[model samples]
Target: MQQHRCGGGALAFCALTVAGVMAVTAGCSGGSGAGDASGRGERLRAEAAGAGGSAETLRRAADVLAAAGSAEMRTSMETSAGGTRVTIRGRGAYDFRRQLGRVTVVLPKDAAGEEGHRPITELLAPGALYMKNRGAGVPDEKWVRVDTTALEDGNLVTGGVTDPMAAAELLRSARDVTYVGETELAGVTVHHYRGTAHLGRAAGGASARSRGALAAAAKGFSADAVPFDAYLDEDGRLRKVRHRFSFASDGPAVEVVSTMLLYGFGVPVAVRLPAGGDIYTGLIQQGRTGEGGR
Candidate 1:
C-alpha cells in the first residue's frame, strides 16, 4: 500500500484521487410520480407526527424515494484526518426503480494551486460501481469496475460518494429517532429528524441489491452506529440527509461527513453500464500525495 493511499484495491480510487490533488461528493424526491399515494402520504405524515413515529418514518425513506421515481442530487463528502480536511462534491441524478445513477465528482486543487483535477464520472448500479477518469495507471478512456460487496465500506465511503439509493436504504436501520421540527431547505418546507442507524440491522431490511453492501459496511466501519440527520418533505419524501462515519486509517481514524441533497423530483436519469472491453483489467497503481495526474 502506498503511504498516501486510504485503503486497498478499487476502494483506493477515492483517496488516490485525493492524493493526486489533495482532494476531494443522492436519493429521494416527492410528488405524483410513481409511488406517490395521497392516502398513504397523509397517514405517513400523521404517523410521523404521532408518538414514536420518527424511526418508522425514516425507515420508509427509500419507499418514499422509489415512489418519486427519480431525482437530481448534489453531494458533499468531507473527510478529516490528521489536521487535514478535504471535501469532494458531486452532482447528478438517480433512478430509484432501476437503482441506477451517475455522478461527476470533482476533486480539490493541490496545495501548489495547479489546474483543477479532472472530474471522475461514476456509474452507480446494483452490486457494481464503474468509474471513469480514474487516474493512476488506468487509461483515460477505460473504466474500472468495482464490486460494491467486496469493498470494506461497501462503496459507501470507498467511492468518495455514497450511492444515493443506498444512502436512503441505510435509513431503514434508523433507531432512537426524534422529530426535530420543521425547517426550510432550498425554499421548501421540510421536517427534520435525527437518529443513529445500525448498518447490520439496515442490511436485513434493505433492498436485495443493497443488502450485501450494507452488510459489508457493518463489518468495515470502526463502529456500527452512524449518527445522521434527515429531512423529509410534506409527502414524506426525503429531501436531504447527512451521515457521519468513522474509518480506521494508518494513523488516527478519519472522520467523514457525507451530506446529500435531493431535488428535481421525477427527473429523467439514464445510466448505461460500460462494456467489459471498456474496463481496465490490469493492476491499479496507487497515487502519492502532492502528485500531479489526477
Candidate 2:
C-alpha cells in the first residue's frame, strides 16, 4: 500500500474552504456541460478527445507528487462572526509515502507580533495520533493506533498532505479528461479539465443509507452520479480540483471543494516550537487561553 501525504495546518485550512468547494463542484457537474446535468458522460468523452495537453504532461505532474517525500508549509486561517475576528498561523511537514504528517500552530492574539510566539503540535504517525504542547516544559504527547484496513472502506480521511498519493489515485481514477477552457488563478493562466467517475449508484446509495436515522428521516437517501473539475498549469500540474456530492432531501446542491498550492516536490522543511510563558497546546479546541503556563 502506498502512503498518502498528510496536509498540515495551512494546507488543511485551504483544503477545508477551497478544497471543500472543489469537491462539491466536481460531484455536481459529473463531467457534463456547466449547467446541463443530464449529458455528463457524453460531454466528458468529447472533452477528453479534445484535451489541449498530451498524456505526457499529466504523467509528469503525477511523477512530481509521487516523488515528493517532504515539504514545509505555512497557513493562515481567519474566521469571522458578528464583529469579532479570529486568526491562526500554522507551519508543518508532510511525509508523502509514509502517510504521516505533523504541524505546529501559533494561536492568535490581539497584540501585534504575537502571532508566531505560541505553539501547538499535531502529528499523525503509524498506528497512533499525537498532539503536543511545545511552548511548555517537557512537551506533552497523545497517541492513537494506526489501522490500515480502514483505507479500503473510504472512511479514513487523513488530516494533511500525508495523503497526496490518494489525490493522485483519485486523479488516475478520473475518466473523460477534457480541455474545458482557461482561467486566471492568482494571476497565472490555467487550463481547466472536467472528468467523470461512475462510482456506481449502489455504493453511493449504500453510503447514504449508513448515515442512519437522521439522514433517513430528513433526506430520504438516493443514489446519484458524481462529477469533478480539475485545473492544471501549463506544466500539467493539477493546481485545483472540485468534487460534487448530493444530499437526498434537499434540492440538488453542491458540497465540498479542494485546492492545492505551494506543492514542493518531495522536499521537507524543519520546524521547531516556540518557547515562552503563555504558550499552550490544543488551542483550537481549548478556545481562549487564561494565561499562567509557560
The 10 consecutive residues of candidate 2 with the worst lDDT sum are 21-30
lDDT of 1 by residue, 1-294 (tens): 222344312234544223221221122333333234456556656777888788888998899899889988888887766566667778898999999999998777651244567888999999998988766688899998988897778888766788988899989999988888877777666778999999889989999989998899888788899999998877788888899887766664677778888888888898989998999987665444443323
Task: Estimate the TM-score of every prediction.
Answer: 0.86, 0.44
- The candidate maximizing TM-score is 1
| Root-mean-square deviation of Cα positions for candidate 2 versus the true structure, in angstroms | 12.7
Q: Residue 112's C-alpha lDDT in candidate 1? A: 27
Candidate 2: tens digits of C-alpha lDDT, residues 58-103: 3344444445455444434332322333444445655655545666
Clashes of 2: 50
Candidate 1 stretches with Cα past 4 Å from truth are 1-11, 14-45, 111-114, 290-294
